[model samples]
Target: MTLRGTVRTSYEVLTSRFGPPTFPQVDDGGLPAEDSTLWLIDTPAGRVHVHNWLDVTYFLKRPAAETRWSIQATDDAALPWIYKSVTGSTAAFSAGVHEFSRYSTRVSLARGYVTYLVQRMIALRERGERYDQGSREHRHQIELSRHVGHMALQVQQIVHDVEWAYADDADRRRWTTLPMPQLADEPESQHWHRWTRWTYRPVPTDSRPEGGDPDLVGMLRRRARDQVRFRDRILPANHRGPTREGKVELYDEHIGTLLTLADTALPDTVEQSRS
Candidate 1:
């Protein structure tokens, strides 16, 4: 299929399932000659972003069917809805990569969902003390804990996928040699060198820094571990304690640490690659 054909087919499938998009598609200017298109569709599940782009390298050699396309959720809550709608299964809060295909279009759709679940886990942890034992909120938290545990494993799968995709002998050695990050350890270092070290230290056994962008790899690893901690330790422990007012503080600290590590390691611009 040509790039335009793939996009048209994708749009048709989406419209059939979710109705027409809220707005017209827009052309996002791209490198000299290639065309790029962006579509935004609002569904009960949340806003979905559909982007299609022509490869720029040896630009003329690739076929239109080869054009890359991505479908992503704009927010966390929309994920469950999308998952159910796409899979036709009861929305299990369980995590892992979810792929849906129609008319040759495939989407990897679990990362955002897991991220949103983590957010929920954090909120429940902060407010656990407000609910009486065996009450609705307490029961909900318990159920969510199980979901979060499954989600953590899903995140681990993603991390493992990345690690395998990019692993090399040197990368393996780096991980085996470095110390893993502890749950209490705050990723405070702003220098790329330090940030990279800290992010890899915690999962030295599974981490591979040589495969793709180091920063992106590190972020994924750190976030994966953070989710695991929230599911296994932080939330459970907090639920057992008296209601606390410091949830927001703790949440901010966690977000700040991730942001700092990201800022330190990510480059200002990413160059598009041709497949």
Candidate 2:
């Protein structure tokens, strides 16, 4: 079969196994090559993109249009898991049927575990305990910490996306109600601040509803600030020593705060964290 025809057949099989999708699949147009087909499925929790490119197919799920908790699978090896995630059954596949819900739960647990390790590392540093620059343990810790931090960032992004997706109208309005700012005649530097200023102009306090939760905007702003801080401070000091030590605390703090905010905003994340 043609690649596009194969993808459509796979999607049909999934729908038949899992019932109909939340909404009808729509053609999302193709790339410049015109050798691919892209279809979008809008679900209650998020959107799925089915991309058929040459001999390979990719299924990508994004919650609330956010890259967090996004899942992508390519080829037959990954198709079973995607199907199981949707159908909550592995009857269609003889083997290798993994569920997205379980995957999300495992990610959450790993994120928590990594946060604990970071805390311990901070405490060790606080107590003046030092590890040799070339020590195996020190290098391992640094590598593992970096990986965990990256994973946690993904999870937090997903949680925030879900929270934003399901937030009350008032909370949602905080984002939607803002007026878009016009770009200056001469755009400023490529820094995030410039992007933020261009994308999200602050709303007047008087315009917000009385007693409305301002935490939504605050969280978004903090996330942006932390991102800049991470890019500027932590990324540059990728080594073991006083330079990294000086920046580690702030990095951990930013990540920790993000995790806390995500968890607080979406306490029942595992239940609806599928992407």
Q: What are the lDDT scores of the predictions, listed in order? A: 0.41, 0.39
lDDT of 1 at 120: 47
Model 2 bad stretches (over 4 Å): 1-129, 173-275
TM-score of 2: 0.23
Which model scores highest in TM-score?
1
Candidate 1 residue lDDT tens string, 1-275: 11111122343444456564433333466333435444565644456665556322322343223333455553334544443443332133223111222211111123433444454455564565478886767765655555544553444354444443446678767765766554554322113223334454233333533343334445544774675466455555545432222333333333443333233322222121111
lDDT of 2 by residue, 50-70 (tens): 444422123223112211122
**In lDDT terms, how accurate is model 1?**
0.41
Give the TM-score of each candidate. Answer: 0.33, 0.23
